[model samples]
Target: MAEEEEEKGGSKKKLFMIIGGVVALAAGGFFFMGGGEDEVMAEEMVEPEVVEGEVLDVGTMTIVLADDDPDKLRYVRVGLALVLDITADSSLVAGRVSLVQDAAITVISEMTSGELRGAVGAADARERLSTAAREIYPDGEVIRVVLTEMILQ
Candidate 1:
């Protein structure tokens, strides 16, 4: 009977050791994996810088793309918004909206499907559009061009 009791106590000690080991591992993992700091750091990292501006929506337009293949018809529908400085005159930008639209259409229509395929292409288009608008607008007036919508078909 004493031997059986001793064996039982040994087994109980083994079980307790295993439970303690598991708890220690979990606590170690939590600390090593940045348990609470990860969440706080992520929140801080995800917040974008605040940009103060007057946004002018230039509206959407559909244009036929200049594709090399004559057998297929390709087109791109794009919408643009102009971000102007807070001190910029919006009335001047509004008055010349037609010119901005014309410039956007011309730029997109000249691009082939291969040139407007991915993120790079989209950014290129935006940069070109912004450049074109900047030429028309006065210095320090136009801040940036935002592509609201772009669909190629």
Candidate 2:
């Protein structure tokens, strides 16, 4: 009975040692293989600061869209605002304000009433106008687009 008791205790110690060894190995791998050097030092870790872009209110536009039904032609009047990148040339945008308004009008006129119905649709239209601005003025960078006073009639 004593020998049996000793054998069971020896088996428990062996199991414990195996589990301890596996845990140590896993922790070691996580420390060594991962970017554990600078990551472990909380003081050395730093995140980049995001600077907000400068906003430039270009102007308002009244776009007339021709619907398929002659009686149902629609017009959308919207106010456009552009978020200029930090490195954008303000003079270029200021000098071409009329051109920018024309682009906005062209973009809004191309869209049908169905595409400009809801908030989501308006957001999409804003995105397209931003893209148009970038293309119309390749030298300028438009980071964000906002549409206001959007009236569908």
Candidate 3:
């Protein structure tokens, strides 16, 4: 009878150990799966809050510059589009609009009749114009300099 009682007590202890192990395993799984309220709250606390800024609308400007020829005095009209980068600091980007326009004029004036005639010439002129615009707004980050209208008369 004593041996049977000892065996029953051993079984009960084994069952308790198994139950404890299962409970521990379940708790571990819940925490690892991000199921606990504390875990969810920690994630929410760590996430970055987004703040919105005021939007500034930049305008496009068109400029007409006379060619180098004194007698004919041919003029080329170019339409340029400008947009301020919201990501960039506002103070730096504010004063570059006029500089970009002036640079475009300077670039167009340098083009000769020979340079403007062929397909290669037009491409080269465009690159030169882009380079000039970039130079003017070194920090301002000019997105694009579009030559909408090119007329030589």
Per lDDT, the best of the predicted structures is 1
Those runs of model 1 whose alpha carbons end farther than 4 Å from true positions after fitting are 1-52
Estimate, for each residue in 49-81, the C-alpha lDDT of model 3 and write its tens digit: 333333323343333344565776555545655
- lDDT, residue 138, model 3: 68
Residue 148's C-alpha lDDT in candidate 3?
54
Residue 126 of model 2, lDDT score: 83
Q: How many residue pairs of model 3 clash at the backbone?
A: 0
Instruction: List TM-score per model, in order.
Output: 0.64, 0.61, 0.45
Instruction: Report how far off residue 30 is in candidate 1 (Å).
Output: 60
Model 2 reaches what TM-score against the true structure? 0.61
| lDDT string, candidate 1, 7-119, tens digits | 99999999999999999999999988878888998888895544547999999999999998888989998999999977788898799989999999889899998898899
Give candidate 1's error at residue 146 in angstroms. 0.9
Report the lDDT tens digits of candidate 2 across residue range 1-153.
Answer: 999999999999999999999999999998888865666776567644434467778777778875677777788889988788787777666777677788887778888888898988798898888788878667546666788579888
Higher-scoring candidate on TM-score, 1 or 2: 1
Clashing pairs in 2: none
